[model samples]
Target: MTAESDPWAAHARRTVGGPRPLLTEALELLGRPRRRVALDLGCGAGNDTLALLERGWTVTALDGSAGALALVQERAGVHRTRLTPLEAGFHQVPRRRYTLVYASLSLPFTPPARWDRTWRAVRRAVGVRGWFAATLFGPRDGWAGEPDMSFITAQALRERLDGFEPVVLREWEGEIRLAAGGLHPSHTLTVIARRLSR
Candidate 1:
């Protein structure tokens, strides 16, 4: 199913566009790990997916938006066999394991009430010694209390990822202007975790 048929295509379009700093950092960290299979959750616009491909990663780009996939399909130099586009939400991904999983600026959209369950699914999807890079909104973020968004305290987030070793925990706080228009002060927490075991 393409992103055009998906109802959330517009929202995804507004959510992501260009390359993000966290995406660059993730690529740097993956160089030594030699990650081949990657899952780019909420890969809107394919910026991150294309980045992964350039890094020689075989990617499964998942987004609930069909427009997002269209954007990916239009990207140059990426082979069709190297990239698999799946228009699916976090909850509906096919059960499988990945060597690397990046969910940039996407976890906040998960329903708070089920955030833990969703996290568990993410944890399960990343294989042993796999790398997981994701962006999560913090309590100080303006969108914290917004509907369908999940925000957690630093301590709470630390506890949630107790089983994994956190390689990077950079707290980003500043005002960002969206391309669509509007500025909001954001408190973003970027986490890079390595799954050592179950």
Candidate 2:
């Protein structure tokens, strides 16, 4: 599909406002990392990537859409030197250690069959003491029944972070604004956890 018509592209355009609260809270908890490196998984439109760059972080912004990556680079401007844009899908994510791995409102898009593998890659990408912040959809979300997407209960999500120390774990169920510009019933889990062990 064309970039103008792609739903993801449209979503990216709408979400360029600022970084999410999960990321800000995670950064506050993390303080100054030994290494100022971060991986912006599914960095739609580079909103979070720009936030990290402004804080002097070397960011790797990964998105499946080339158009999205272009937008990231464009928005980065002078911060482009610190930004590494990678165009790849969740299943194609490489295992690379980083001080922080942030995936906002993206993991749920992974197909159920690829969820385990993708989650493993994401987990391994976090170095010891590193932080991970993400927003995951719950089974009650409007898209939960779709076979191409993955949804988890709050308890199950916590179980998956076996080696991580929970910093911020919040779950909410109510009407949420959609990327395409409307309201919908949604259940989401937002987490910022620190990896305690390898």
Candidate 3:
């Protein structure tokens, strides 16, 4: 499909020169020690992947959309050597360890039935003492009940984050303004956590 007809492509194009506040914050929280590798899971438009590359991290960027991966490759250009773009869904995430795993607004897209398995794979990818930064949809999110989406309650979140030392825990429950100029009541939990010892 043409970029005009593909929403993912259109979003990737729009992200080219935009400010990525979440990525900035995530990097700040991750500190400046300069890790060697990172995995940008569900790297929608490659903003996070680009940021990782700019910071001198060899990155593996995975997205379900081919158009999104294309945008990532296009944006990488000279940095292509440090960037690996893979077009695969959540179920196809490769088994590997990484110093950092970034998954912004993407994990919830994993079908509810497959979330546990996916989370297991994600944990394996992070290994011990690795970091994880992501946004998880809360039960009250507008899209929580969607068939293919997964949502967690506050208590459930605590259980899920049990082994990690949460560096940043920000929760919001209110109307979210969409890029399409529409608003929807939503709840989201943004986290930057480090695996302490395990």
**How many residue pairs in model 1 have overlapping backbones?**
5
Q: List TM-score per model, in order.
A: 0.88, 0.95, 0.90
Tally clashing residue pairs in candidate 3. 0
Task: Give the distance in Å from residue 94's predicted Cα in candidate 2 to where it truly belongs.
Answer: 2.4
Collision pairs in model 1: 2-66, 3-65, 3-66, 3-67, 4-66
TM-score of 1: 0.88
Worst 10 residues of 3 by lDDT: 13-22
lDDT scores in order: 0.80, 0.89, 0.81
Off by over 4 Å in 3: 2-6
Q: For candidate 1, what is the lDDT?
A: 0.80
Comparing 2 with 3 on lDDT, the higher-scoring candidate is 2
Q: Which stretches of candidate 2 lie over 4 Å from their true place?
A: none
| Root-mean-square deviation of every model | 2.7, 1.4, 2.0
lDDT of 3: 0.81
The best candidate in terms of lDDT = 2
Tens digit of per-residue lDDT, candidate 2, span 29-147: 98987799999989988888999999999999999888788889999999999999998988676677999999989899999999999999999999998999999999999888999
lDDT of candidate 3 over 5-33, digit per residue (tens): 67777776665664256667877776775
